[model samples]
Target: MAEIISDLRQDDVEDTVPGGIAADRLRSIIERIEKLEEERKARGDDISQVFAEAKGAGFDVKAIKQLLRIRKQTTEEVEQLENLVDLYRHALGM
Candidate 1:
């Protein structure tokens, strides 16, 4: 499986949202994020760093990480179900 980088960490030039964030505020956020990433990486991707940074930012670390995990979907092992669905609905005339 390939490791993924969050969209927030990407370097795309286009603004994904329409009439999006003001340049100055966006830049500030990016700079802070860079510092956060540096702090995270310095600790070798220790998740505790995420909590620590969130804490320093005056945000709830535990809740934020929990929210980040709420919508994750793993598509890695769905091949068998997909094949079965196709086999019944298409191939087998059910």
Candidate 2:
């Protein structure tokens, strides 16, 4: 991977893009990318962060973005649960 990246960097230097980047400059760019990759890896996630969130939330992501869609809780159920919570909180004079 490092060799391929170095080759690409050499090609990029030869095929200069506007500003002239020195070899050290290119190495710095590669190093920054590598550091970002390492940080991302330490967090145990891919470059995209949605997977990390899903993992943290204990989600099964086989369904893809289907999980990102919010499922509306039944209004009746929500009210009932809220009432139960209120009752519980008040029972202890909270």
On lDDT, the leading prediction is: 2
Error of 1 at 61 (Å): 1.3
TM-score of candidate 2 on Cα atoms, chains taken together: 0.30
Residue range 4-69, candidate 2, lDDT tens digits: 445554556764455454556667788999999999797765525777677678876755444343
Report every candidate's CA lDDT.
Answer: 0.64, 0.67
Q: In candidate 2, which residue pairs clash? A: none
Q: What is the alpha-carbon lDDT of model 2 when measured against the actual structure?
A: 0.67
Off by over 4 Å in 2: 1-21, 45-65, 69-94
- Residue 1, model 1: Cα distance from true site in angstroms: 27
Q: How many clashes does each candidate structure show, in the order listed?
A: 0, 0
Candidate 1 has an lDDT of 0.64
